[model samples]
Target: MSRKTGTLLCLIAGSMMLIIGCSKSSEDRLTTPIPPSDCDTVNMTYSSDVQPILEANCYSCHGNGNVNGGVTLDSYTGVKLVADNGLLIGVITHAPGYPPMPDGGGKLSDCDINKIKDWINRGASNN
Candidate 1:
């Protein structure tokens, strides 16, 4: 192809790609995500939502009968004690006068933190 013709074809292809990219649906273009159903924190439950998160995150030092700092998170009653005393929120959120939990690990994801917070706010029930 002639150089000018080749260049014109390239430009046309690029323009079409640009148009396609900008034409994405609003859902596709969302600045804030539609929260995933996988992380459903709504009306958070202790056994289903809260406990799993703790089992994955907190159980290392506080589960399987491994009690650290007098905190045991392997079961509902243990978790309730921490939740009632405000230690759950304080430590997870790294509030002043409370030790940062996970000890050596990074802070829990905001979603996990929110889930625990929601569970705590919802009376920290065993159910």
Candidate 2:
């Protein structure tokens, strides 16, 4: 093969590999399983169970005045606003209405998401 032709072939192959590497679906990237919490059987309150999740993943923007979408998750009441607005649950569950939380972070484990749902279903109690 001529030098130019060989270089062209290598470039094509490299491009194909790049495309394939970047196209992995969300599930392909997730490795950790969300563990079941004691919050499941009983009420999952924001103060006890959900706050930590938000603190770890959401507090940066939502905690202070620079609230995204006018919503906050710093306090139980703040979290409840988004939860009642139906966006929190939707985002967490990857439902149709809103984009997922943490935008780029991997999806939360099923158990963790279920706890949020349970809290929402139970009226998003602060206690």
Candidate 3:
């Protein structure tokens, strides 16, 4: 082929490959499972399940010296207060009329929410 024709063919081939490579849907491109979280919602406990989630997601704003919205989650009694008043579920689940919690941190994972709900359903025990 002539030099110009050959260059044109190569550019066309490269463009086709680029288009095909970029056309894949995100899921199709991702071979590994997204996050692969194991959600165990059974037999939830305060020390093991609930408290840790609160510590990670809530304590920054609602624990220790910082008590936003007059809520403190540093103690079981404080946590229980919200749990009893339905504020725990309402805020975490981002239900209307209840402010979504963790504030700027966004909503908790579905697994974490389920664990908290299960704990509440089981009487929001101290255990």
Candidate 4:
């Protein structure tokens, strides 16, 4: 092979490998379940803990005025519907087969997510 042709082939191969390496891994794509160090997960409540996180992160698209994707999270009942059906947890956790919540927004902090998980584990109470 000509020197120039060999150089071109090497460049192409290197570019492909770089692209492949830059791709997100399965674990990186999923919201990693992280335990909160300072968050008090003992008594998580919908009103106190979960609502603020949702209001800040999710209400833009999923609130009463919007209801995008047929999901409204403005009220406790609305939140409860998805919570009961597992969509809330699934999306928030970025679990496979479920669309991530807050869409293009960053994933919820470990403290917030852990609080939500704790609340859900405790029956997703209205309180």
- TM-score winner: 3
Q: Against the true structure, what is each candidate's TM-score?
A: 0.71, 0.63, 0.71, 0.69
lDDT agreement of model 3 with the native:
0.92
Q: Highest lDDT: which candidate? A: 3
RMSD (CA, angstroms), candidate 2: 12.2
Q: Identify the runs in model 3 with alpha carbons over 4 angstroms from their true place.
A: 1-37
Q: What's the best-to-worst order under TM-score?
A: 3, 1, 4, 2
Residue pairs in steric clash, candidate 4? none
TM-score winner between candidates 1 and 4: 1
Instruction: Please provide, for model 3 over 1-127, each residue's C-alpha lDDT reduced to its tens digit, 9 standing for 90 to 100.
Output: 8999999999999999888777766548686567645788989999899999999999999987789999999899999999999999999999999988879777998999999999999999999
Query: Model 4, range 79-122, lDDT digits (tens) per residue?
Result: 99998999999999899999987798888887788889999899
lDDT of 4: 0.89
User: Candidate 2, residues 27-48: lDDT per residue as tens digits?
Assistant: 5667556554543635777777
Candidate 2 wrongly placed segments (more than 4 Å): 1-41
Span of 10 residues, lowest total lDDT, candidate 3: 24-33
Alpha carbon lDDT of each predicted model: 0.89, 0.79, 0.92, 0.89
State the lDDT at 110 in candidate 3.
Answer: 90
Model 1 lDDT tens row, 27-89: 476876666667667799998889988999989899987899989999888999989999999
